[model samples]
Target: MDKAISFEQVTHTYQANTPYAQNALADVSLVIPNNSFTAIIGHTGSGKSTLVQHINALLKPTKGSVQVLGKVITSATTNKNLKAFRQHVGMVFQFPEKQLFEETVIKDIMFGPKNYGVSDADAQQAAKSAMKLVGLDESLAEKSPFDLSGGQMRRVAIAGVLAMKPEILILDEPTAGLDPRGHKEIMDLAQQLHDKDQMTIILVTHQMDDVVNYASQVVVMDEGKIVKTGTAAEIFADPGWVYKMQLNLPSSAEFAQKLVDSGVPIGKLPLTIDQLATKISQLVAEGADTDE
Candidate 1:
């Protein structure tokens, strides 16, 4: 698969030249496959947020480079000519609903495209389309964004980014404070974009269940470096390493481990509850047939 984003030995430093100067990223090399649902996971201060910020040049590498959509961003790369390139990468920051400040839902959603030089008519149409894509009702277009529920506000914020029609979407802990339903809704929206729109998705999250359920690729980070990159199953295969990294196992995986310890004969660990149930059922059926 083609790469939607590539980081070559990238390092980002904050507060350079001061006592607080710290490396948020260190010698990071990664390639995110085009149209893939990739998740970056780690404990607090593990550089998950710092990593995704590079996709849209929100934080340029202090050393090395980031190539996204064929545009290279380095420390020397200036924003003067980044408009076209940046337009292709949309970032939905943590608490994106907090970014919504427009008087109406449609207006908030239209801001991004309009700022990108789209005409009002075209921007409005894009906003409407994006709203529908994010599961927002057309009737809410004229409603003040502040009047919406937290989940609806978040959808409006995401619709705003979707209006720009980015080729790659970077979500920084998109489900941070949402309720169970909201979390699933946002995740489903991301899957739809990846599957139907062929959009590359890079998500930074602490939710292991979300990683197991949604992410096709997982990157584990620590301190300021990329520790490992593999499928979710591969990442979770070694429970010892996962715990050593201070990362929580997905709930289903934890339960499966207990069953395995009890001599359940589980060959492969199940990452989700549904997978665990299916495996147990199959084992039960096999045992019943043997007894018969």
Candidate 2:
């Protein structure tokens, strides 16, 4: 598969050269495939956030380099040259709704494109299309973003990034602080973007269920180093390692293990509820045949 981003021997140190200097990333090398739904997971302060910031040059690598969507970014890379490259990578930070500042929803969504030198007419058109994509009605265009509910405010914030027409979307705990329903909505939207728009999604999250449900590939990090990278099934097949690293198993995986412990013979460890249900049904049918 084609690669969306590559980090080569990258190291990022905070408060460099000072007594407080700490290595957030150490010799980290990774390649995120183009159009893949990838989840980056680890405990807090495990470099999950630091690794992703390099995707759009938001944080430069103190050593080595990061190449994103064919654009190379090094410690020496200048900001002026990154504007065009950044358009391809849209980042929705945690609590993105806090960033909304324009007087109206339309104006807020239009901010990104306009900042990139797009004209008012074109920017507004993009903004409208983005709003529609996020399931926001065109009628909401006139209302202030703050006037909307927490969920609506979030949708507005996401629409702002969509207006940039990014090829790769980075979500940093996008569903944090949401109620269960709102959590599903955001996850479904991420899935929709990956499916219909063919956008590569880099999701940094702690929710193991979201990882199993939405991400095809999983990257595990610890102590500023990548511990493992594999398909969600491959990663979760053995729950021991995940737990050893202080990571929670997906709800399905945990429940599947309990059923297995009860001698249910759940063949292989499944990553999601739907898969576990199918496995149990297959076992039941086999047992009925044996009874005959």
Candidate 3:
């Protein structure tokens, strides 16, 4: 698959040359393929956010380079004419609902496209489409965004990003601070966008279950460096590595490990509940056949 984003030996330092200088990312190299759902998992202060900010040039590398959709950004690169690049890369930060400032939901959603020079009619149409995609009712379009519930406000914020029609959508803890149902809804919406719209999604999250359920690829970060990268199954197959990285296994994997310890004969660690169920059913069938 084509590369949507690439980082070459990228290092970012905050307050460089100062006494309090801190290296947020250290010699990180990665490639995110187009139309793939990638989850970046790490504990707080692990440079996950710093690393992703390079995708759209929100933060330039203190050293090395970053390439997004054919645009190369270096420490010395200028910010001129980056509008085109920004248009193709939409970033939804943590609690994006806090960024919603327009008086009405539709206006809030339309704000992004309008700033990008989309015609008023087209922007309005885009807003409606985005709202639908995020499962927001059209009737709420005219309501004050502040008047909506937390989940609704989050949807409106996400819709605002979707209205831009970005090719690469970077979600930084998009489901943070939401109820369980709202959490599932946001994740489902993300999957819908990935599956139906073919949008490349880069999700930064600490939720192991979300990573197992949604991410096709997983990147583990530690101490400002990528310690592991692989499919979710490959990454979660070894509980030791996860523990060493200061991360926990997805619930299914943890349960499977417990079953294995108790001699249940589960063949491998399962990343999802469905996989665990299948393995348990197979064990049951085998036991019945042996009895017969």
Candidate 4:
């Protein structure tokens, strides 16, 4: 697979040369493959946020370099066409709905494309399509975004980013504050986007279940450095590392581990409910056969 984003020995420092200077990212290097869903997990202040900001050039590294979507961004590099680069990399920050200030939902969704020089007609068409993509009703297009429900408002905000037709989508805690249904809605939408649109997704989240359910690859960050990188199964295969990183396994995995500890014959650690159910059925079948 082609590299969609790459970081080479990247280091970022906040308030450099000041007494309160803090190293947010330290000697970090990573590669995100194209059209892959990668989850970044870590405790607070673990540099997950700081790392994604570099993808769209929101923050520059104090040392080393970051290459995103074929554009190389470095501390000393200047005069680069950041706008054009940003067009291909859409970032949906936490509480994105707070940024929606347009009088109408449709207008808010169209705002991004318009700023990127998309024609009025094209922008409107894109916005309408995006609204549909996010499962928003056409009737609500003219309604005030602030008047909508929290879930609807979030959909509108996400639609705004989708209207830009970015090749790479970066979601920073996309479901930070929402009800259970709202959380499922947002996560399902993300899965649909990745599956249907084949968009490269980089998700920064603390939800281990979301990572297990959606992410093809997982990256664990700690103390401004990447401590581990692997597939979901590989990362969770060893529960000790997860605990050491101050992270917990998905609920399903944890429960499966409990069953294993209780002397149940679980073949492998399961990451999802379905997997766990199947393993349990297998164990029951084996026991029945043995009794015969």
Where is model 3 more than 4 Å wrong at Cα?
289-292
Q: What is the C-alpha lDDT of each candidate?
A: 0.93, 0.94, 0.93, 0.94
What's the lDDT for candidate 1?
0.93
TM-scores, each model vs. reference: 0.95, 0.95, 0.95, 0.96
Q: How many clashing pairs per prediction, in order?
A: 0, 0, 0, 0
Score candidate 3 by lDDT.
0.93
- Residue 114 in candidate 2, Cα distance off native in Å: 1.1
Worst-scoring 10-residue span by lDDT in model 2:
264-273
**Model 3 lDDT per residue over 1-292, tens place:** 6999999999999999999999999999999999999999988889999988889888999999999988899999888878778989999999998898999999999999999899999999999999999999999999999999999999999999999999999999998999999999999999999999999999999899999899999999999999999999898878988998889999888998898899887877878889888888988999999999
> Taking the tens digit of each residue's C-alpha lDDT, what string does model 1 give over 1-292?
6998899999999998899999999999999989999999999999988888888888899999999988989999989988878889999999999988889999999999999899999999999999999999999999999999999999999999999999999998999899999999999999999999999998898899999988999999999999999999999999999999999899999988898899888888899999999998999999999999
| Better-scoring candidate (lDDT), 3 or 4 | 4
Give per-residue CA lDDT, model 2, range 173-254, as digits (tens).
9999999988999899999999999999999999999998999889999999999999888888778888988999898889
Candidate 2 residue spans exceeding 4 A from truth: 283-292
